[model samples]
Target: MPYIEVIHPDEAEGRLRRIYDRVTGPGGQVDNVLQIHSLRPHTLEGHMALYKSVLHHPRNDLPKWFLEAIGVLVSLLNDCSYCARHHAAGMKRQMSGDTEKYEGCLEQLHRDHPGEPFSDAEQAALEYARKLTIAPGFVVVADLTPMREAGYGDGEIFEVNQVAAYFAYANRTVTGLGVHTEGEALGLFPPDGEEWRHG
Candidate 1:
């Protein structure tokens, strides 16, 4: 379950069918997050496009692991465990399956004691993500000072901004619509390419 009816990959047809084919994970499965957009397939297209570009694009100069950590932290702050758990698994893999290291990282995030494994600049980004997630209206340019002081340029800061913002949108969608990870293939990364590789 989902709160709303979702078209299963096997049962999908036409445009929905095509989209599902491209986004399927293990065993031709579509995550509930993606399938929930079935009735309006184009939005699914937009969502996946944004997801790929934001989290998996080649142009993102930030380390993919760091971006995944940002996603996990932002999702946790929003109380969106569905997204958090998924991203945590991905982050663990990105860190080379270092379970001890991964758990320590997560503990730091949960306790807001960011350090070790994460550089000072990374900690600043995480702090910025917390503010943006919990109080977006109150965030100001002054906030970027710490991140810059920690060594992030404006563009790298923007990557932090985008990843945090994207997770906020995604977390809300999951929480609002009651999406779950019951059958999701955890930790699957977005495909890399100029365009989706059609299957």
Candidate 2:
């Protein structure tokens, strides 16, 4: 149960109803994270827009699965089971055809150790995420050297940073609000063929 009342999709009106429709079109279900912002529907709208732009934008330099991996890592570092479990499921869905890789990634995250299963770039990115999430003040320009060497340009680096930073905010929101997963998770794949529109 959530700390506050969440507006169910079926009972939403106006903007909230429209956003819920987009999130649960063709029989999809609304996750608790979105419901947390139900009291302020515009915030929910903003949240979804930022999420899609960061993780689902077509021009994103990093793969969706990799971004999801970062989300899981940050959530775990924060000890946020809600975000971790949800993103882990999303990561699993992204790697659906290759169960081995998905399981390997989860195991690596669980151990808090980056090993052979992940590429050098992924390792570097994960390290950056760990430091940023746990100690943002300690993050210096030199911290990005490995990522640059791993072939990530300035824009890609920014994207990774933003994703990690966003999740930190999201994880805190879920934790502070005592939000529960309630057996509801967002879909692993993008909705509406990759083009998200605002109402």
Best by lDDT: 1
Worst 10-residue stretch by lDDT in candidate 2? 190-199
Report the C-alpha lDDT of model 1 over 1-199, residue by residue, as the tens digit: 6788888888899999998878876677677888889989999999888888888898889988889999999998999999999899888878888788888888887866478778899999999989999999999999999999998999999999999999988998899999999967788876566555322
Candidate 2: which pairs clash?
Answer: none
lDDT of 2 at 103: 85
Q: Give the TM-score of candidate 1.
A: 0.94
- TM-score attained by model 2: 0.91
lDDT of 2 by residue, 1-199 (tens): 7778888877899988888777763346777787789999989878887888887787888888889899999999998998899888878777756889988888888766576588998889898988998899999999999999998899989888989988998999899888887766444445434444321
Instruction: TM-score each candidate.
Output: 0.94, 0.91
User: What C-alpha lDDT does candidate 2 achieve relative to the native structure?
Assistant: 0.81
